[model samples]
Target: MRRVKLSDQIAEDLRRWIVRENLGPKDRLPNERALQDHYGCSRGTMREALKALEVEGLLIMHSGPNGGPEVQQTSAEIASRQLRQFLHFQKLDFKHVYELRRSMEVALALNVVDRLTAEHLTALEDNIRLCENANNEQERELARQAEVEFHDILAEASDNPILVFICQFLNGLIRDLVDYRAGSLQEHEAFGARNVAYHKEILAAFKARDRDAVAKAMDEHMCCAETSMQQLDAAFYSDLLSRR
Candidate 1:
């Protein structure tokens, strides 16, 4: 087994303390010297461990007297960033990410269709209008955010916090894939517009409380997204292999 670094072990121990103590946001952690004594590590090693927690957004460091690391509420942004880093490190390509998204999102859509309210429908309509009227790069970004909002709302409507959390986490990855493949924006836009149409159809199904129609629409939408991503991957890998 690979030997874990002392700093890492210190970090893990501190993390356990946070949980065991039920530390809340703004709860002050033990001072650096205290941690050094408790963990039986050097001051430098203790600081390194604290820095890791700080980077993870679990703790914030303050200076001066009464100054120490404090626990912070974890944000979805933090989780998303960590997940993005992990995905990048693993070299999981855009296609694989899309496949994972399609599987989760399609099911989320189906579950949410019957739960959507008039307010939800209105919000979705506004998002589609934004997409339709987007004329510049800034507007296009707003349109993309609106598109994400629509799905996010659907995930929320599913009434499952776990699903909402997962969708929120994955949203950043989806944005990254879209940005990375923007050289194919025109093609993506074409497919995306079709996706908007499918969204409308799913909304209609929702209005009618037609579960089967909703399921079919979601499945079709995911199938199209999967097909497009696969094609893009094929072209990308083919060019890469040709260069080598």
Candidate 2:
């Protein structure tokens, strides 16, 4: 096994301390001297560890009086950025993204059906309307954003942190890719209409709280999107492959 850095180990120990103590955001951590003494490490090592956690958005270090590293809420934006960086290195094509979404999104919809709140359902309906009302190319692009927003809401409503992060990251990646090939997306007029219809069906399923129907609706929506995009823009897959 690869050797772990001392600072990394120290950082993890501090994280455990936070959890064990049920630390909340803005809760002041122990002073540098105390942390160094408790961990039996030098000030430099302790500081390095604190710095590591700070970079992860788990703590904020302050210098003056009433200052030390304070616990901070972990933000999804931080996690999303890291995941995006990893996907960039992986050089995933659009097909890879769609395939992954096809495999998992149905499960997400099914899981979230029972969990959908009044607010979540309302937001989803509004996004569907936004997509339906998109008239010009510019409006269509905004509609596409609203469509992604709908998926983002679904992911958040799932209330499973892992699912939430994966879905949001994938949705973000797809949006970026679509924006990269905006011309191709614009060429697919039928796609926008079909997408709105599919979302309407999915929304209806969600409103009914029917898990099986929701999963089926989601599966069909993904299949239609993949087929329509591939057929309308013959170079779509090739463009994505070249990016890889």
Error of 2 at 14 (Å): 1.9
The TM-score obtained by model 2 is: 0.83
Residues 50-160, candidate 2: write the lDDT tens digits: 999999999999987767888999888887887777887875656778878886789789879999999998888888777878835657677666777878889878868
Model 1, range 1-244, lDDT digits (tens) per residue? 9999999998998899989999999898888888889888898899999999999899999999888899998786888787787887776666676667777887787678668888988887877677667634546555555666677778768887777777776777767765665444546566567767877887788888888888888788777766865666666667678879
Which residue pairs overlap in candidate 1's backbone? none
Clashing residue pairs, backbone N/CA/C < 3 A, model 2:
none
For each candidate, what is the lDDT? Answer: 0.76, 0.82
Alpha-carbon shift of residue 123 in model 2 (angstroms): 1.6
**Model 1 stretches with alpha carbons more than 4 Å out:** 114-118, 135-146, 238-244
Ten contiguous residues with the weakest lDDT in model 2: 228-237
Model 2, stretches more than 4 Å misplaced?
1-3, 40-44, 228-244
lDDT of 2 at 236: 65
